[model samples]
Target chain A: NAGVTQTPKFRVLKTGQSMTLLCAQDMNHEYMYWYRQDPGMGLRLIHYSVGEGTTAKGEVPDGYNVSRLKKQNFLLGLESAAPSQTSVYFCASSYWRGGPESTDTQYFGPGTRLTVL
Target chain B: AQSVAQPEDQVNVAEGNPLTVKCTYSVSGNPYLFWYVQYPNRGLQFLLKYITGDNLVKGSYGFEAEFNKSQTSFHLKKPSALVSDSALYFCAVRDDILTGGGNKLTFGTGTQLKVEL
Candidate 1:
């Protein structure tokens, strides 16, 4: 399986510009997440989707939005990018059939390096 | 609410020596913990996870994590350090209270492991 993959591995954006990072998974996972890793720190969640047509807020959801229009895809958008948004973004996906599988492990993508100037 | 902590910002070990990256977590109930490694300018890679079964879970790259419920710790260990293993290591915990399939992860600040010959 190709597992999870992300687009635009690297990008540079000016302040207030908008961009969307795309994540695709071939594992047929029901859960998808977007997270950002800051310099010399751990990752913080930006948004997540349980399944198609559903999205939810995460640890650090502000300034970002997400859409899960399809089961194999999750998109993260920065409507108004800022310097603070410059970070390494990662996308992960996993399958869950409820019950004991609630704690299923996640598989991550290659990540997108975004630099907001 | 659940969280993970990596006490050391960095760890340096000589090649062929035993190595460990410390991790401690906080959760209301049983914890689902994980370890991941990130190379330079790359995404996070899954290492191992601790669930219901054994306390010691073996993961990729000959890495293992020992889970201690009493101390609420999950430390990553390698019998002999390798320069190729040099990377940023992260410890994460699944949320104990989230309903359904969310079980979003809370990660540590990360520890940079450097193995010098």
Candidate 2:
């Protein structure tokens, strides 16, 4: 099965442009997250969904919005792209939180490289 | 606040030799630690995690992590390094209070591991 898949693997946009990055998982996981990877910054959480129809803010949610209307899909939107938002974006999903007693392993999708000029 | 730290920016090891990537964390309550690997231009892959039980946790690709509660560290290790093991490694943590139903993983600045043949 395609564990986790992201659409538009690469994209370039000018400042003020808008776009959406789509993430889908076949694992039927309950938790999905959007993260951005920057040089020397590791991965910063942008947004997340605990379940379908429930979305929440993450550490770096300032420039992004997320929707989890379907169980398998989590969409990240850039209403107004900024140069600062240029980074590799990743989507991950996991069965539950914590470990041992919970399925805390997060399966990630191939990243989307976004360049905002 | 909760955070993770990878003390080394890069680690160099010879093939067939043991390798260790250091990771330490700071969290308010009990910490749920994780290790992930990222290949070039790809998303992070789950390596392993430490939740409640054992101090040593084994994960995919023959990687494992040792959790030291006193030091608040979860260091990733491999018995024998392979050239294929050369990649960026990240350490992450989830605080008990910030569990938020969804797993909010706070990641450290990654450390690049280079295994020389």
Best by lDDT: 1
* Clashing residue pairs, backbone N/CA/C < 3 A, model 2: none
TM-score of chain A of each: 0.96, 0.95
Say which docking band candidate 2 falls in.
medium
Error of 1 at A94 (Å): 0.6
Expressed as tens digits, the lDDT of each residue in B1-117 for candidate 2 is: 888899899999999999999999998877888898999988888888887898999999999999998988899999999999999999998745545647678899999999999
Candidate 2: TM-score, chain B only: 0.95
Clashing pairs for predicted structure model 1, backbone only: none
Q: Least lDDT summed over 10 consecutive residues: which range in candidate 1 chain A?
A: A94-103
For every prediction, compared with the true complex, DockQ reads 0.70, 0.67
Give candidate 2 misplaced runs (Cα > 4 Å).
A97-103
The sequence of per-residue lDDT tens digits that candidate 1 reaches over residues A12-86 is: 999999999999999889999999998666899889988999999988999999999999999999999999999
Q: lDDT tens digits, residues A1-117, model 2?
A: 999999999999999999999999999899999999999998988999989999999889998999999999999999999999999999999887444345467899999999999
Model 1 TM-score, 2 decimals? 0.96
